[model samples]
Target: MEFMLDLAVSVVSLLVVGFYTWSLRGHFYSPKMATGAKLISAVVIATTLFFLYLAWYEHQVAWVQIVGLVIEICAAALFWWAVSASRKARLRFAFDPDHPDSIVTTGPYRYLRHPFYTSYLMFWSGWAIASSSTWAVVPVIAFVIIYVSAALGEEKKFSKSPLAPEYEAYRRKTGFLIPRFDQR
Candidate 1:
């Protein structure tokens, strides 16, 4: 019964992610959005949720739970920051993937090349650690690989734009997912 409930939760989470991604498809990368990528994300989320359920059932230590909570909070903050930055950039400046517009240098983009993906990774990593189950780690690893691949692909596509040179310089200075506090 517990397994079934967990599975349901996993499915629901995947559906939510899928819907969100679908809604943002055209605004970001390839207007069509890759079906394969979406499917992969769904599988990864499902797997992670399953492992999370197992971990929850096992009952980890209090300290681990607290650490997990902190990580999750950080992840949420990062995600929110990324979204806000994106919105500001969209409003203040124009970005047309089809037309190849200017690169986004403000907001979170000023620090991390891929703030959204970074936040997502942090969230998943925290979830895996919180679960502290070997099974949970599997999905986290898979999610990292998938996200990295997608980011690389997006970068390649974005490189064709006129702002490619500027973006390249930004990429050289900033970390892929994590922001460097010491560097201005």
Candidate 2:
């Protein structure tokens, strides 16, 4: 049972990496942006592979395995939804906040200011939970910090841009990384 669950987690991790890579096609980036983007992508890929490596030896409890799979799937769905919604927005990598010409407020963006980051958090948290190791949380923490930094950087760019007013309004209606039901 442990091995089977581990194998499943490994498969899911690979799919997540594949999906993310597929989503990046055709997006142009400047040299600086490309370097940052590559670093980000490398970190993500390494983290996902680390999860697979942990699965090879660490045995996860059945409940954690099941729950992790559920969270990963949900995160994947959210990612797809966000990507689909921003299909026409010409969304750039989060590393390049200044590259986006417009703010996306459709689909998942309508509710979450950073749905992509939220989904990433969910995915990483799910994997950490599945690993059933205390050390697994290190990567999760690192990713949380990274995502928050990226989101804040983007927010700073937005505040400095002409879209500040519109983004402020949108921010009021959306949550930073979670759904904000109590809109003012």
Candidate 3:
């Protein structure tokens, strides 16, 4: 039972990542970060990969792993939904200096301003937990910082876009990495 669950987790994660990565490459991505946030991103990616490899698959499926997997699945679903919704809205997935193709408010974007980063964090959390290594959380913390920085960077860029005013309003209502219910 645990083995099957493990396999399911691994396969689902790979498929979602592979599909998203491919889809994202089709758009014009910003070659730069809004404010040098790119520096930490490199460390984040390298550490994440190192920790993920350290958390080898086939570890005992403990409660923590199961919880992490559940979060990962849900985050992946949200990520997929947001991406599809954005594409449907013709919102190009780039971060160029120019204005964004559109300001997305549908799907996950309505709740979290950066669902992709949120999804990555959730996925990383799951993999780290499943590894059953207490030390895995260290890299995971770095992962969170990196994504949060990237999300903030996006907001900074958005602030300069044609949708600056609208984006500001949206930011008030949306959380950076998670859904915020403080606003109606």
Candidate 4:
């Protein structure tokens, strides 16, 4: 019964991510992009799936699973919010030093420059916790490195856009992957 429950949770969680990602298909414009960024994005997907699979296969502590669920839900919510807000910017999912249609500074972007990446971070960390394996840390750390690289690379892309000045100011004032509590 416990196994069945874990399986169900895993299925639902994966479906949510899969379906949402699918829906984003043509929403983000794909300009001529960095090959390395594409590779990193692929790595993000691979690492995420591996960690999530581990989450279900490994024995999960009840409290940890609950905490994971909470974090995952929060992350999903933020993703949705960020996506909704990004529509105005013609948000693309990849890194293109030439593809800054607009610099989004409202909604989720107001608090964190990379709310989308934050969601990914939360989602993976939650999955790792849900896995309840100390070994899960490996993939979690990898995800962090990959996501940070992509985020920073994307920011560099933005710096080349028409909004470079504003983007620079935003970058200085906003947090990278987390909210800047220091903002006054």
Going through the candidates in order, what is the number of backbone clashes in each? 0, 0, 0, 0
Q: Candidate 1 or 3, higher lDDT?
A: 3
Q: What would the per-residue lDDT of candidate 1 be over residues 1-184, giving only the tens digit for each residue?
A: 4444344433434443453354354234444435655566576557655755665477555566556556756776776666666653431111223433546666777788777778667766776666656667777788788778767765776687677777788778887877865454
Runs of candidate 3 exceeding 4 Å displacement: 26-59, 88-101
Candidate models: Cα lDDT each: 0.60, 0.82, 0.66, 0.73
TM-score of 1: 0.74
**lDDT at 153, model 2:** 84
Question: Model 3, 1-184: lDDT tens per residue?
Answer: 6666656656665665565566545532555444444444455456546544554543555676677678778767877777676765543333334456568887788788887777778877876766667777787788777677656666887788888999999988989887886776
- Segments in model 2 whose C-alpha atoms lie over 4 Å from true places: 26-32, 97-99
Residue pairs that clash (backbone atoms under 3 angstroms), model 1: none
Candidate maximizing TM-score: 2
lDDT of 2 at 77: 95
Q: Cα deviation in Å at residue 16, candidate 1?
A: 10
Candidate 1 Cα misplacement greater than 4 A, ranges? 1-30, 88-102, 182-184
Considering lDDT, which of the candidate structures 3 and 4 is the better prediction for this target? 4
In Å, residue 82's CA in model 1 sits off its true spot by 0.6
Error of 2 at 131 (Å): 1.0
Better of 2 and 3 by lDDT: 2
How well is each residue in 71-100 modelled by candidate 4, as lDDT tens digits? 877888888888788876777655545647
Residues forming the 10-long window of minimal summed lDDT in candidate 3: 89-98
